[model samples]
Target chain A: MAEECYTELEQAIQVLVANFYKYVSKHSLVRNKISKSSFRKMLQKELNHMLTDTGNRKAADKLIQNLDANHDGRISFDEYWTLIDCPYMVYPATDLCK
Target chain B: MAEECYTELEQAIQVLVANFYKYVSKHSLVRNKISKSSFRKMLQKELNHMLTDTGNRKAADKLIQNLDANHDGRISFDEYWTLIDCPYMVYPATDLCK
Candidate 1:
């Protein structure tokens, strides 16, 4: 289908899906999941503008602890979605997406 | 901050967040939640190209039923997020965003 056929919402979803794979593809060892270290790097490199304290390893680890539903030390697709959603879900008024 | 400062990932998240309010703000009585009726309208209008059978009321109702996590018959923000994410998370290879 042509790109113009997609609505804004659909395009937005595409960006998110593509982004996950973009990061995941960076490391072969992790396969479908993002290891703890890779997740940290993703945060530092990709999410620094929206998220604070990406420079602090301790803060980043704490974030993973909160979003790691299975406590497996790996960030799955679901976990990654939830992590990116924290700001929007918690404070819709002060959301970064404005 | 300048829009250019945001990374692609951050911009994508913003689009998702902005889209939520774009729909939610349409109905005053629903508050933070998207009523069942409004949710159906959102699907038919915004997701028809990506989701099949959007014209079918039954399909739309079934979708809300699955995404209604609290069983409140209303689509909350998180519920909406999960619903939009189903296509991507379930079939990453055939994701609509691509």
Candidate 2:
């Protein structure tokens, strides 16, 4: 049951990524909605926000960290855009070290 | 190029569906955000809204119509929920006739 639950969460992440990616391609103007570098930065900031635990931090944080490929301490919106097209599963803790 | 374009669109649809499905399972309360029946009804109404072209009709319409599985001229919310688990490709026009 737990496995099934996790799967649902994973599916949701993929779906949102795919949806955004789809629109990004069709409407190049969507890029104007936010910059690539800015996106990554925002995502990382949101991740820290999650750690705070004052708000709906876990979900909010996971939403952002779930996107950050490298924990190199920062992400740019441009790098964030590329992930939208890829089929991404969560990175492992060890994977983050690289 | 056109084919690539279509693929992006298909991906987007799947992503959005998957994301919603994921949230629905994890946070059952998200269901309360609206009723299953109301969701379907709203979707169909949105479809009709798209046909009007007054606002951002097509995107708005496609968003809803894409969700409505049966055109019985109506969709109830419960039926809408099940598809979140299934990977749905668009129904063919002939299939719609049924």
Candidate 3:
């Protein structure tokens, strides 16, 4: 349950992250340790324009529903984390691919 | 557990959203229904610069750990959502501030 949700958050963040790839990626505040190839790979998914695009946040809202998983009508930190923590695990894997 | 977690997500997002104040908020994709007054308030918190600043994402990493909350070492969507959902509840109240 948790893994599925964070997978979604990572999906959403990566989509939105494309928004600042050029600016934030080079800023050093976040780039010193993270590998560029992993960064690029994360940036590239669904990247015709925005892997992070909320093109129809209806999709986002629905995912929010999924994150809430238990049907509590509100998402708890645990549920939400499941949705967003995918990158922690994914980045290293993407690096291995490179 | 959930409320405490989303409280954190909201806290972190407001900080990050400040980064896009000049650009993303003005964009139609995300702003249509999310009230501007609430938006402004979100932009203002810890606003010397970045409410969203990862100035020391050590803070963020720590929070991520909190979202994971279960000592699971990996955050699930449930945990992540809790950290980021506070704004959804706070916005209507912030509009009342206006």
Candidate 4:
């Protein structure tokens, strides 16, 4: 699809899905899953601004452990969606819509 | 936070969260929830490109019915996340990262 045809919301969703694939290793046994190390790197690089503990290895590891819901030791798209809960952290002070 | 400080991924996430609040009624009895009518308008305006049935009222209603997990006639943030599953529809042809 043409980039110009996408709405801002559609483009945002594409950015999210594309970011996940960008960090997914091609050599992994799973086709579209992100390995633990890559997921950590993603947190540090892509989400450092939003997540306070991205710079803390231990905290990041704990978060990864929690997100690995299927015990597959990797993050799937569904697993990654769980991080959306952190929007509270992103807008801590005010209700933007209010 | 300054707009320039956000990574592309962070900005994308903010867009998703903000879009939800934009449709949410300020006077809702339960704060932050989006009513059925507002949610439908959101689908048509924000997600028309990604969701083929946005123009079809029956289809959109069915989709909202499925998304309203609690059957409360309104959508919560968690319910909104379910729509992310449609990333498959957004990138139908090619492996975008490959």
State which docking tier applies to candidate 4. Answer: medium
- DockQ numbers for every candidate? 0.61, 0.06, 0.02, 0.63
Estimate every model's Cα lDDT from 0 to 1: 0.74, 0.35, 0.36, 0.76
* Number of the top-ranking candidate, with lDDT as the measure: 4
Tell me the chain A TM-score of model 2. Answer: 0.26
Which runs in model 4 stand beyond 4 Å of their true positions?
A87-98, B87-98
| Minimal lDDT window, size 10, model 4 chain B | B89-98
Q: What is the lDDT for B68 in model 2?
A: 57
State TM-scores per candidate: 0.84, 0.22, 0.22, 0.88
Ranking of all predicted structures according to lDDT, beginning with the best and ending with the worst: 4, 1, 3, 2
- How many pairs of residues in model 1 come into backbone collision? 1
RMSD of 4: 5.2
Flag regions of model 2 displaced more than 4 Å. A1-36, A50-98, B1-36, B41-64, B68-98
- In order, the first chain's TM-score in every candidate is 0.78, 0.26, 0.34, 0.84
Screening candidate 1 with a backbone cut-off below 3 angstroms (N, C-alpha, C), the clashing residue pairs are A14-B97
Which pairs clash inside model 4?
A: none
- Selected candidate, larger DockQ, 1 vs 4: 4
lDDT, model 2, position B72: 42
lDDT: the better of candidates 3 and 4: 4
| Tens-digit lDDT track of model 4 for A1-98 | 79879789889888988998998879857888999999989988987777766767777778878778999988988788776554533463222121
Q: Residue B30 in candidate 1 has what lDDT?
A: 66
Model 1 lDDT tens row, B1-98 = 68788888777788888877766745677677888888778877887667766777877787789889999888778888897667533442242322
lDDT of 2 by residue, A28-95 (tens): 54442333344444334322221222134354335446555655323333334433333331211111
| Model 3 regions more than 4 Å off | A1-51, A87-98, B1-98
